[model samples]
Target: MRRQGIAPLPFAQGLALLDAVLARPAGNFVPARLDLREAQHAADAGEEVPALFRALVRRNTRPARARTSVTSAPTGLRDRLLAAPAEERIELVTQLVLREVAAVLGLDSADSLAPDQVLKHLGLDSLMAVELRRGLSAATELSLPATLAFDYPTPEEIAKLILTRLDLPTTPEATPASAASDAPGDATDSEALLGWALERLSADQLRRSGLLDRLVELARESAPAPEGTATVPAPAEPAGTLDDERSVDDINAELNALLEASGFDLD
Candidate 1:
């Protein structure tokens, strides 16, 4: 009679079965050397092969996700303001100005005044205070009063003052050029234009190069001669040797010795 039941296989036998199952040439198995050049060419042509490989690797090797209940919050006021609408953005800017002014003027929140009225009442003396106005002008592209530093000491007041002074509509669709044109004689615009040109230059070509000075000198030299005076060519430096004593043979001998030491086959 046949056995009614079979015993469980040994660990070794179980492992062997597993190995055989894995080692079999199945449809899912991919060869290591399978036309990599062709695959690379296809990827270069913007095929999805690279993305597919990335997804496969990510899915297989990525760690298990951690269980979490906490949702992330926005970092700062600036970040929150950036995500806000145009009107909200203006409100945030006004608040920022007010905070800065309050800090600078040593005034309490209750003592906040209009920007223009503050400048008109208070006497501004410090250059540093003027610099604050310059900074604000650069940032907001607003043409603040010359006495803004002294009069409109607080940011909240300044914001309100600027808002009142501003005649332009609060449309977000206005171009930067149009905004810049409104603030004529703006130093920030000149600085920006210069900065843009400077960025295209290599740093090495600019620093400690004296190239700008040389350019100025060349410009002066190329200018039209006064009256009918003939332009004279600049004198050329003497060539051949430094002291006019060393012969060509001496230079060649030194070069040959250097080449020989460097393992150059002169023969």
Candidate 2:
């Protein structure tokens, strides 16, 4: 009898070949119709083959794209904050910080007293103060002094302390050299600085508005600050501008009066 050419292996043996082929890296092999037919045949014979192929297909699929960064939107919180005038920025920060405090105290929904009143007369303790600070810092990325919680306990007082520590433009006299630098390429730098300031102010406002807790929770699920040096203070507005009025002492007195009016029961 004439010797028969070694015909392709039977269906089971062909499936073994297919498995061996698939075992190699994806880049190394391109499957042929013959190989696919053999696999199908084997799968039809075996109970587990369909599940195996389905799993592989699912594993190899790509995920859908996620939402873009909120910072890029024209009317986003960041943009709105950046666009605000200097005085408005301070007011915004104060409101945000109080909102955060209210949220944390589980008072977000309840129509309780104003946040400042809660801080003053509702018996806020030292531990709660630190908790507030931690929450605010995490949301706004500004390091507030712990003593501020005691020294400027009310929401309004805390807002002033934050603006001061951030070296915000409280008056025209304190405007920095950077604010006056008008080099050809200064606009971009100025915008970036302004954006950073806006971010801090927004955080402060969130804290004041009883929204800090929500912000903190949201931050945990998102990208964090990149590793590097701490953020520097934003350049102050030009001295001659409306922000140029008043001295540091004046700002301090204002803060003190607010704290006193809030009935902070400090020693």
Candidate 3:
């Protein structure tokens, strides 16, 4: 099956197959290799293969093995994802899905895949789909369901699903004003929206965007301690009129300027 690009049956599915054969409910029974000696003994006694299978299955069944470190999320991946731009984030996740799918199909590269190609049409079976889901879950650090391929059905859709699960934003301009108004459950107030957006940035991202220092300055000026209480002293002011009065919108404009200087498009 592996040679033919078919994924090996998962242990859980093996147990489920046993359940169906035995006319019993599904279980957490561990699947082990069949004993040829036991089969021969049963055959010598004139018993059928199904009878031998039933007897051996009950005897060999044990608790399934505990999950291994393969399920652990890669270190610092969450921070990197948070620091990436919206479009870059989507492309990264999309490529992740494409790569996994292509590998499962034994393809040389994901370039052969169309974004909207149906996974099943590309020769993915149930077992292969399960493998794809496992790979995506481990890579993205998300607990994805087994029916991922069936639910989303395409690389593009799966990428969107992953982004939604990670609570990451899509392209900022993708959400139109009409859609925003229609979805009243969304953070509609300007301050609420700003807070939500800011939460997505990591400390490194804030520093790189040139907003961390400005934010610290604003905090000091806006939150003065009472007269007699000696709190930690603030850092020396920089040689600029940055200390001049400014609104939150003005600070946001400065961030936009910094983004533009870094070759990002504000529009």
Off-target runs (Cα >4 Å) in candidate 1 are 1-72, 75-78, 127-267
Query: lDDT for model 3, on a 0 to 1 scale?
Result: 0.67
Candidate 3 clashes between residue pairs 3 or more apart in a chain or in different chains: none
The residue ranges of model 3 lying beyond 4 angstroms of the native Cα positions read 1-76, 169-267
- Sliding window of 10 residues with minimal summed lDDT for model 3: 52-61
Top-scoring candidate (lDDT):
3
Would you list the rank order by lDDT, best first?
3, 2, 1
Model 2 residue 213 distance off true place after TM-score fit, in angstroms: 57
The candidate, 1 or 3, that scores higher on lDDT is: 3
TM-score of 1: 0.24
Clashes of each: 8, 28, 0
Sort the candidates on TM-score, descending order: 3, 2, 1
Residue range 1-267, candidate 2, lDDT tens digits: 001112345688678768988888765754332224433444444423444244332221344467687675555333445556676866777777777667656575425545466474665667667777877786666877786567776777777666666654334533467654533345667545644543444433444565544434444454533454122222255657663354545444433333233333223
- State the number of backbone clashes in model 3: 0
TM agreement with the true structure for every prediction = 0.24, 0.35, 0.38
Candidate topping TM-score: 3
